[model samples]
Target: MSTSFLLFFALAGSVVAQNFWFSFGDSYTQTGFLDNEALPSVANPFGNPPFPGFTATGGPNWIDFDTTTHNNSLVFTYNYAFGGATIDANLVAPFEPTVLSVTDQVNQFLQTVASKPASTPWTSENSLFSIWIGINDLGNSYFLSDNRTSFDTTLLDAEFALVQQLVSTHSSLFDVGARNFLFLNVPPTDRSPLMLAEPASAQAMLKANILDFNSQLVEFAENFKASNAGVTTLIWDSNTAFNTILDDPTAFGFIDAVSFGTGPGFFWINTLHTTSPANVFWAEGVADVLEGTIF
Candidate 1:
């Protein structure tokens, strides 16, 4: 066999060997999940063309890249993320009422577990559950107020609450025999185009809020691990990855590193999202960090 074929087999083997991958979060992690419900062809399981969802990349998002191209083909990918979802809807709700909140997504997973088909089964050893949220939660809060002290306090409490919910959700997932997990924290939203347009003082406050949220997230992960047994978890710091790219875009192979647009060289697709090129970079960073942990 040729070298390319051998390499393909190696990568495919890694993916097929894993039990299942279930992703839960907002648009950043969404890939037309609900659209899959109506798709006839299982080949493009994510419902790409007619149902691109709200992927900022203008194409397959990271989850799509991992389950489809990255893995060659995934055994199964149950992505339950909505474009504007939040951990708690009361804290932040997507534009559509049908969008599943983080809690709702977890509940849906539980329902999926209960009604799983015989052809596709899940096991604790091979299954992976990942979550990447909190941007909207912070975004809504930031937009609601400009007071640094109040926003900071409220955001921190919300982060703590989210972690607590995760602990409970993981316990339930564990009961159903899901062990491996990956958690991606919030990135630097303050640096995004929309936020960048804000006054310097507001921008600085937003950055500080993100830092507080991420710090609390780390602590929550530690607590969750301590409380649970035989569960392997990896928290990918997306914040650091984003910052690194912003610090030196050329190093990561970008042309218009400073500009924000949909064209070549630009990073930010809008004030709220990154371009496809930047998404690829972000996806690679995530894949690299998950190297030894998941595979």
Candidate 2:
């Protein structure tokens, strides 16, 4: 066979040896994306996306994800998420790398899925897939506005359309074909680093934007399921996830981490991402959702 065929077979062999696990999206995935290193560029300082005009110490460097668990997973897995990326960034303007277009992102997912050999032991049963992007699309605009009007109705309508397109296209891969799909929802941007450091005046303006994004997210997910049939997409709500401890930190059993500032009830290494315990906790949430369903 040709050299390309030889390499393909080698890769297939590796996949056959381990289960199939794939994760996609931006910074949320970045904790597990950057291959165990922190990304200095496209950083979110305050802990998640921010509110309008709320500036922070610097760009986000969410480096506290549970790499040990992410890295430990031996499956033929890869994280193709680029920081500063948004759900609609595919159709709208680009964010960080802008080089890899939105279509390119989708193709990356397709290629990874296609990479698995039909004869591989992992099958659709134990395979896992996840997509966790969408905050930046709305958060970036809100952070720039410094006012409450960022919740422009026109923009939100467009956002919903973008969500529809993403789900529709991605669904084809597994909607009726592949196995389990972990579809993540938007985490509240008001709690992001940008909003955290901003003045109350500016924050008051962006609150609506946060609401818009969340509303659009809920709309999209519900609409998707309502419109489609035989869909097995799972939603991971960091909004609800964050709310659990946002009001009461001690409940989650958090410790203080200087870099993350005051405290979100846990040690956030930085203003934005989670510390090791938190990272693993987030991972566990994903893992739990993936429970026996994977096997």
The number of the candidate with the highest lDDT is 1
**Per-residue error (Å), model 1, residue 249:** 2.0
Residue 161 deviation, candidate 1, in Å?
A: 7.7
Colliding residue pairs in candidate 1 = 19-126, 194-271, 256-265
Question: Could you give candidate 1's per-residue lDDT for residues 15-48 as a string of tens digits?
Answer: 3342367778888877766632543134444434
Q: Which pairs of residues clash in candidate 2, taking residues 3 or more apart in a chain or in different chains?
A: 43-60, 44-60, 46-193, 46-271, 47-271, 47-272, 50-195, 51-195, 147-205, 148-205
- Regions more than 4 Å wrong, model 2: 1-19, 31-76, 90-103, 115-126, 143-176, 255-266
**What's the TM-score of every candidate structure?**
0.80, 0.61
**What is the Å distance of residue 47 in model 2 from its true position?**
28
Q: On residues 155-180, what C-alpha lDDT tens digit does candidate 2 reach at each position?
A: 44554443344345444445313445
Which residue ranges in model 1 land beyond 4 Å of their true spot?
Answer: 1-18, 35-42, 45-54, 71-75, 95-98, 114-116, 143-174, 256-258
